[model samples]
Target: MSKDPEDRLTVGEVSRRTGVAISALHYYESLGLIASERTTGNQRRYPRYMLRRISLILVAKRLGISLTEVQHVFDTLPLDKLPTAHDWRRLSRLWHTQLEAKKREIEQLERELMGCIGCGCLSMKSCRLLNVDDELAELGPGPRRLDAAQAA
Candidate 1:
């Protein structure tokens, strides 16, 4: 007998409820981010808990987080059970830190671009931000002063 509609959802139902495509849900399953059970006829069926996980995956991806990174976060939760309130809270804290770091990096990049406009690579002798002096050559190629990122 088929499961009642309230307890488990068919792939189409999940897609309809979440606005995610059936193929995407299958992709998520292949990535081990979400799981489903097979019916006797080998049809896919998902527990309602997947909605929460899918929502988180979508939101994290929107923030530029890769699915692999999100899977790493999910790995920290117990494999045998659905995620709990505390689990989501911990994930939120971890993502909040990552997002804050990214925000800072973007801000720094913007400032450096502004500084670059002023420097114009015109003053090789005095441009600390762009030109790599002989003194910094020992550290190898690439921008010598970017590690500190003082932005000129």
Candidate 2:
């Protein structure tokens, strides 16, 4: 379909253009990661640029960033206007810090895994190193931590 310069996109159209499922678009909207306007018929219509926003969100998620963190990053932008190239460059610069931190974390995990494997210290108490517990303690409370049963 030929799109008019001023025409807004239906959710389905946005999905088709972005290659994201319509339900996911709705979820993104609900999460305030994207936005839309309601038509007279109560149908959701989005600005054309939301396609790019969705693409950015997908990329950020793939990088293991949470939606909340992505929303915080988006908060740096002017909500009423589409982002300019300078805005994208500034945002990309912020991402480098995150990328570096992830790289370091991965490197540490690699060393820990290698040490554990080499020493045959898969069990917690008998291990000479404390890599697994240390990382879990840093993470606080999460599924990454050993459950009580597993800890025993």
Candidate 3:
């Protein structure tokens, strides 16, 4: 905390304290994952508590949570209000479930990738990894759905 308890941190101070880039902090604000007050001169002043929010956002991003998902979590709180302990608990539970699902998906993909490596053929018609057989060739060309399904 700053020596003066009432003194708010500027964007630079927050960026320095959190190790988050200033532009990334602005982007998080734009994405509604964090909020700040604009000074009369148009400078951004962030409460010290915003550090926690930024930290949470960084952690979520590391876990493959999209900006949209981060915004959804922020939406649970009132604007400019920092997360409470209860809120953190709830968010942690949600993230854990999502992380588990992503882990399973990665494991499945790794298994499929191993299968593909076992057979050097990456073609849709013959790649056992994709489970694409001759019958599916009539449906489309390429790994039509293998790549798209993972993203969606």
Pairs with backbone N, CA or C atoms under 3 Å apart (clashes), candidate 1: none
Q: Which one wins on TM-score? A: 3
What lDDT score belongs to each candidate, Candidate 1 first?
0.79, 0.75, 0.79
Model 1 regions lying over 4 Å from their true place: 1-5, 118-152
Q: Write the per-residue lDDT of candidate 2 for residues 1-152, one digit (tens) a residue.
A: 11444667888899988889999898988878788887788988788877778888887888777888888999887654566788778867777788899899889878766767857645544343554455555656554436755887
Worst 10 residues of 3 by lDDT: 1-10
The clash number for model 1 is 0
Candidates 2 and 3 compared: the better one by lDDT is: 3
Model 3 segments more than 4 A misplaced: 1-7, 128-152
Better of 1 and 3 by TM-score: 3
Clashing pairs in 2: none
Give lDDT: candidate 1, residue 127.
51
lDDT of 3 by residue, 22-96 (tens): 999999888877777767898988877888898888889888898798888788876666678898899889999
Candidate 3 clashing pairs, residues 3+ apart or interchain: none
- 1 or 2, greater by TM-score: 2
